[model samples]
Target: NFEGTFNTGAYASWGPTVANRVPVHASGPYFIENYRAKSYAVHTNTPSSGAFRGFGVPQSAIAQETAFDLLADKVGIDRLEFRIRNALQNGLPTATGQIFEKGVGIKECLEAIQPHWARANAEARAFNAKANGSVIRKGVGLGSCWYGCGNTSLPNPSTIRFGIKADGTIVLHQGAMDIGQGSNTVITQIAADGLRVPVHSIKLIDGDTDLTPDCGKTSASRQTFVTGKAAQLAGEALRRQILRKANVSEAASLEFSDGLIKAYEGDTSVEIELTRLEPNAFGYVFMAEETYDPPVKALDEKGQGMPYAVYGYGAQLMELSVDTKLGTIKLDRITTAHDVGKAINPMLVEGQIEGGVAQGIGLALMEDYLPGRTENLHDYLIPTFGDMPEFVNLIIEVEDAEGPYGAKGLGEHVLIPTAPAILNALRDATGVIVAALPATPDKVMAALMAHNEE
Candidate 1:
């Protein structure tokens, strides 16, 4: 039973976008039959609010996760076990009634963190017990989240084109923007596997509208799932053409190297010289263009439908020390489990998870934007190098039938559970529930005083 209203203010007249998403995501990634939420973008004098990392899920999660923590305490259930009992699984319907036949990994993510959660809880209890009336107290908290991969049940498609040149070189027209998120590397890896060639043989030309097809924008965590699938299909299509030209069976093993293509089947082999092959209409030995769109059903009047083809699940645990007298929180460690369906590149996935955790820390403790008072970087602070804590990232691989090579998006999913986890840990340490965000020292002190009075 939650209700919300989003005020985009003056820009609501011109930028009335994402107004539909606030309510849709306010349900917070669980199965709720009688849930209802209302959101509106009203005109005001203040600046308009725009899209950020998790669309509206992070804001919704703050409310839902806080409530879940209270509910777990009320029901006398371990927080982790309570989440596991209600964790989404395959064949279950979401709040929007979207039924997923596979790729539901929330339960797996929760289960993966069981050992870490137990150990951390025990350590925190021991440390707190030893403090014995000291101002410093230690606590551990957990948060779980689920994020839709692409646009909610809308036709957001990606197109990719690739060609094999006369010199046996592979050129991939990757239209997805990297923006330092490693789309260039991840999509290239998928293409290389699809074409069955060494990764070194591929050359990438990305984010150039004139040279590449429309792979869509690099938002909504869609590049990895949508563009990757397009690249995979294009690579497979080019491979098929190459196989046909070599006069080899589909089961035959093919190798490309040194300006030559070789296909082998049993004791028989066929070699095709790159110099002798005829170029196609695109002036290449083989070329392919493919498009991929995650299947989704349109929302009806009630804003319920198949919103996303796949979702990424994650759970994070935070261990921290809170100083009651000084009203300061120091993070010691973070344990995270992410269900990415498959890790196309382990390094990239870990980097994303770590980066997301940093952002989450900032949002939880320091970063707050006020138009007049905090207009610049100095006034609007963020986490520094000294603010980072020890990190332990766990990768959970639950095969996704619709993903490229059984892989899903991990960009936005990394941070969804972070802020809530930190806030919950603060509550555990000080017994103070922060209703507002960025629980600064002053706010924490105020909340502590209020709780003490109560």
Candidate 2:
């Protein structure tokens, strides 16, 4: 059983929103037959807890993954094996009773980490054994997670508009905000591929309400899956129009070059001059507007529904050393495997994974918010350059049927498994489970003393 609350009653009467996410994400990613979770948004004087990177899913994952580690120890099963036994797969019903016929990669992610897990365990054991009377102890821990791509059981759609200007220029209206997550680059690539045009030829107008259509907000990791699909469809639509005007079949190869659209079918060819066509109201000879909404169903009285069209899966392993005397933990390395369906931009995917790990390390070891006392970076600390460890990201490509070019969302899923993995690693090193978050030095020392006394 799990219970959570997000209090918003203090300002609810004034139109403040409540905790709409706690109940949906409290179950985490695995299936639970007899599980029970209760969540609430009550009135309080403090400000409301709004959506963060992973919404409320990260909180839920912390609770569930920590509990699973403890449970695995109690049952005398290998932690990794324990998770594998309960991981969701095809034909398994989620806690929400949503059963996926395909594209469930939880098991594959778990398997992908086996070699790394074994190596880390061996290295940690060897290091700890040699430490002898030294205060340093090394350990390795694992975490697995799943995340739905879009809004839970709701319609969140994205629209994309692409046009070929009479001046032989291609313009794409991209409404998704980048926020430094590389949305601008990735979506443009998808659009370019769809139009069969060079990436440099496409001019992008992004996030301007006056010029672009609604691609929705950059949340729920929906841009690559939803907005990218819209871009893809718009590209295809424009391509079809071009081919029709050239009187070419789908098999015909088409290219845009030197202000002319050329189509080739074996020994025959046709060319359409860009200047020969009249411009539309949008100032383009060809234009396409398309929208995509992931298939989903609303939740029932029991909170059961097709909450997401697709889910991304991941497993991560953390290796670290603990100093018993100083109550300090140092991370050595992290090995992560993510089933992204397809990586539209591998570099961007790696960046997301690394950034998530940094935050996860902070959440597990150092971050704590004290309202009055902690005012700035000095007090409310985050991971710095010296705090990061070596990272290995393995991109797992399990195709999603509904994703744009078989690509699912990777943003939120990267961080879901991070904090829990670090917490479990702390337990492995010190032989004590720090139930409270952060596992700060004081709390870690207290838990160590308690374990030693026992």
lDDT, candidates in the order shown: 0.86, 0.85
Error of 2 at 419 (Å): 0.9
Worst 10 residues of 1 by lDDT: 12-21
lDDT of 1: 0.86
Per-residue lDDT for 306-349 in model 1, tens only? 87888888999999999999899999999999998889999999
C-alpha lDDT (0 to 100) for residue 349 of candidate 2 = 93
Q: What shift in Å separates residue 99 of candidate 2 from its native position after superposition?
A: 1.6
Relative to the true structure, candidate 1 reaches a TM of: 0.97
TM-score of each: 0.97, 0.96
Top TM-score hit: 1
Model 2 pairs in collision = 7-42, 9-42, 9-43, 10-43
lDDT of 2 by residue, 376-441 (tens): 888988999999989988999888889888998988888888888988898898898888878888
lDDT of 1 at 332: 96
